[model samples]
Target: MKFQRIGEHGAERPIVVDGEIAYDLAPLTGDIDGDFLASGGIEATALALARKRLSPITIEGLRVGAPIARPQAVWCVGLNYAAHAKESGAPLPDAPVLFFKTPNTVIGPFDDVLIPRGSAKTDWEVELAVVIGRRARYLDSVDEAMDHIAGYTISNDVSERAFQLEQSGGQWSKGKCCETFNPLGPALVPRDELDPGNLRLRSFVNGESRQDSSTADLIFDVAYVVWHLSQYAVLEPGDVVNTGTPEGVALSGRFPYLRAGDVVELEIEGIGSIRQTCRNAG
Candidate 1:
């Protein structure tokens, strides 16, 4: 099932999309979003509710917002794809590599991506994002990790390779935490509703395809990454984990970079696509 949030008269409401978003589920789910999603674990309850009543909302009338409201963190993995690792001249890591960007970096699906001041290596990374569903720590195995996932969304891991590689001595956070780095949502499909093994992940800049691949290429798959991160920090429901992007990022490819007017998009099979227009940060 796809869970979403929409705006009505400048106010936002949670919605369950059966066919369209505006058919209204107030009769079925009671409240807009915070409840339904935070209610009984969105995956199970949403599917169960849709079985009895279809939503009255039409997908067109409502303005879509990020599927998960106010995520706690927007975490990411770098160079997790073998080819991407090779292109960037990075060695294959022995374990799941991790880094983080502030949740403040999160923006809506179709929002604009800003090129930070003095940024010359602004690039794009099309990634598969996992949204956590419960507060978890010390997960024992990969299976236990998968159980913590609430849903999936497409993310544009917009990066500034200069800030990431040049100025930072410690971590990649400098290049990654620009104002509009994380573009999330369109739809958040519950984990059980889709298969993660094979999804055609693709990215395009200014109408030309750039990054294109599938989840099958990750050096460390989703389950292990989650389980590993759990040992360090507790995973909370609604926190986003960018499972990492496949190859074709500017940092890895022929050094293509975004300009003031470039349009960027990332899509994954089944989940959905997200787009952002590029503009100079004033």
Candidate 2:
């Protein structure tokens, strides 16, 4: 089953999707957020649907917001893909390189992505986004990390190379935290329904392929990333962790930087795809 929020930004209502039909989750929960996930919302939703307690609704013309409500924090793993590291002329890291995007940077998968004003190196990265389902602090082992994950979703980690590398005195978040930089979700697939270990994730620009890689190439996989972060900071429920992107980005000099009106599409196998039109920030 897939969980989603449908309607305008800031006013979306939660719903669960099973095949062709969509069911309202309003009777069971107000929204799909940290509180809902931490309290076994997914399990309860399953049970409610099984007993025909949810009302089926049509979503033909409505907007689909981010699958999970705005997360408390959007954690990102940098240089976790060996090929991507090589493409950017960086050495393989001995440990996971971490960074963050402000939670508000997250937007609906199909929404517009604003090109930060005065930007020339806007780029695209298709990543596997993990949604935490429980509070994890100082986790004992990587094996136990899986238990805290609620589900998986797709995140288009839009970036501005110049801001990320040259302008900010070496901090990546400046380039990362622009409004609409993180386009996330058409649906959040439960962890039990999909394996995050080897899914294929890809990105395209203006109908041309830009990124094409698999999670199999991740230098630090999902479990290791979660456990590794837990050793340092507490992982709160509803926090999103972007595992990182693969090679074939504009930063590699393989393609031109994004411009206003360019369309970018990111897709992950099983989780689904998101498309965004780039527009200059007003």
Candidate 3:
């Protein structure tokens, strides 16, 4: 089942999408959060649907929020895609290069992306975000790592190259944490509904294609990423792991960086799509 949060910002209610119909799950759960997922919210939601306990709600013109309320941490993998790594002038990493985007970067998929003050290198990255369902620590193998994942969602790993490279002394997080940097989700598609390893994910800026790539290009893959991460830090339910972005980003110097009034659209096969408009930050 595909799950989503829809309503005004900060007041979204949970719902499950079955085809074109959206059934409100607010009667069963207030919001889809870390606590909800840890307590088997997926299973409970399925049961609720099967029992015909939810009412179909009209979602016309309503906003979509991040599928889960707020993640514990928005962990990211740098250079996980071969072409993306090459485009960014890095060699294929033998192990995942990890980074963090503060939880505050989480915003609805349709929200406006802010071009931070004095910014000039704002860019976009289309990524498949893995949402962890179960606690993971020291996983023995990649298969074990897959068991901890709840589902997948689309995340535009928006960045600013100058802040990330030129001014940061080489740290990437400085450019990654601006407001609305991570536009996530039209839905959180369960693992059973789609193949995490093979999916077509892409990005379009102002109706012109910028990045068109697939998860199949990922050098680390999803399972290994989670397993490798578990070897050090603990991953909890509702924690989002941005597996990495495929090539076609603005940072390649092939395309101009984003500016105010530009619209960015991100899509991942099976998961869903997100449309964000760029705006200048005051």
Best by TM-score: 2
Which candidate order results from sorting by TM-score in descending order?
2, 3, 1
Residue 80, model 1: lDDT of 89
State which candidate, 2 or 3, has the greater lDDT. 2
Q: Rank the candidates by lDDT, best first.
A: 2, 3, 1
User: What's the true lDDT of residue 97 in model 1?
Assistant: 81
Better of 1 and 3 by TM-score: 3
How much does each candidate deviate from the true structure in C-alpha RMSD? 2.5, 0.7, 0.9
lDDT of 3 by residue, 160-248 (tens): 89999888876889989988999999899987789987899888999999888888888988999999999999999999999898888
lDDT for every model? 0.79, 0.94, 0.91
Deviating ranges (above 4 Å) for candidate 3: none
Q: 2 or 3, which is superior by TM-score?
A: 2
lDDT tens readout by residue for model 2, 1-282 = 999999998899999998889999999999999999999999999999899999999998999999989699999999889999999999999999999999999999899999998899999999999999999899999999999999999999999999999998868988999999999999999999988888998888999988888899999999999999999999999999999999999999989999999999989999999999999999
Q: Assess candidate 2 and give its TM-score to the true structure.
A: 0.99
Relative to the true structure, candidate 1 reaches a TM of 0.91
> How do all models score by TM-score?
0.91, 0.99, 0.98
